[model samples]
Target: MEARDKQVLRSLRLELGAEVLVEGLVLQYLYQEGILTENHVQEINAQTTGLRKTMLLLDILPSRGPKAFDTFLDSLQEFPWVREKLKKARKEAMTDLPAVASVRLPRELSLPAQL
Candidate 1:
């Protein structure tokens, strides 16, 4: 994850918790690799912190029933973060990714979010 993404996750961790951090990081990595689009990030991030929003961000059990949700989940699982887990994965070219989403980040890195 990028420093900025880590910063965002760390800030969220304080308001949320470690589980949220993990889910946020997973979504962050997805965003970085273009699995999740800018619109998707913005929509999800705008939601108040909660399991429903988290599930939407994680592409699980979305309000739209199984068909819509499954398609999104399938695409997400094909993201480099998932597909490259066991391989020497290079960062996907930025040209291939949607423009970076403007997620809120804390001004300072919380200790746990530091590298």
Candidate 2:
């Protein structure tokens, strides 16, 4: 495979795993909180499936040029509110562990004992 194809596959693997896990967690929480109804869950599942179908179609295309690849990249848009909330949460979590920000280990200690 070409470099671009390898990079795209690596990114798709990472993103697909992360999206399914995170969305599953968020959906479960929302359901428990009574924020999402059964119908809402069904609708979200359908949407997620549609997205996967779209990605599969794109992946199976015979030839993809830069423009096609750029379009694919553009489709993976991040939700603004979700991104902001995650950023805020990460900042809060990091604030409680000030020493973690400057963590380091000696080279000898960083490696496994077997090495």
Candidate 3:
């Protein structure tokens, strides 16, 4: 078998384990609890499958190694509000950008004429 396939099979062993499934399911339950705001919900919905996959990955990270443990430790230090935002981000990174403003872009994002 190809090296990548071997890695994938090895990873499947961990992610599908009972403890990983329980933790991932717990996170999903928390997400479905109606605590997240509308924008949060929309963003999550935008990448629903990817988010589910990441949450699964999170559960398997410990099996992956020390860098994974470091990431876990860092997560513990996140600011409360930042951590709240990241709970969603932990599952969906791209969909977690700051919300957009009115129809026009924010001035920080606006561009002057090419001239």
| Range of the 10 consecutive residues with the lowest summed lDDT in candidate 2 | 53-62
lDDT of 1 by residue, 43-74 (tens): 77777775546645544223333343223333
In model 3, which runs have C-alpha deviations exceeding 4 angstroms? Answer: 1-54, 75-115
lDDT of 2 at 78: 44
If scored against the real structure, what TM-score would every candidate get? 0.32, 0.28, 0.22
Error of 3 at 103 (Å): 71
Worst 10 residues of 3 by lDDT: 18-27
Shift of residue 13 alpha carbon in model 3, Å: 17
Scored by lDDT, model 3 comes in at 0.40
Per-residue alpha-carbon lDDT of candidate 3 for residues 1-115, written as tens digits (9 for 90 to 100): 2233233334444433322232223334433443333454345445446546445444344444334323432333323443343344344533544686769788889888684
lDDT of 2 at 43: 56
- Per-residue accuracy of model 2 over 3-82 as CA lDDT, tens digit each: 34434444455444445422435444444444445665555566556456334433432144434333333333443443
lDDT of every predicted structure (CA atoms)? 0.44, 0.44, 0.40
- Per-residue lDDT, model 3, residue 51, is 42
RMSD of candidates 1 onward, in order: 17.3, 16.3, 15.6
Error of 1 at 27 (Å): 2.2
Q: Which stretches of candidate 1 lie over 4 Å from their true place?
A: 1-18, 21-24, 60-115
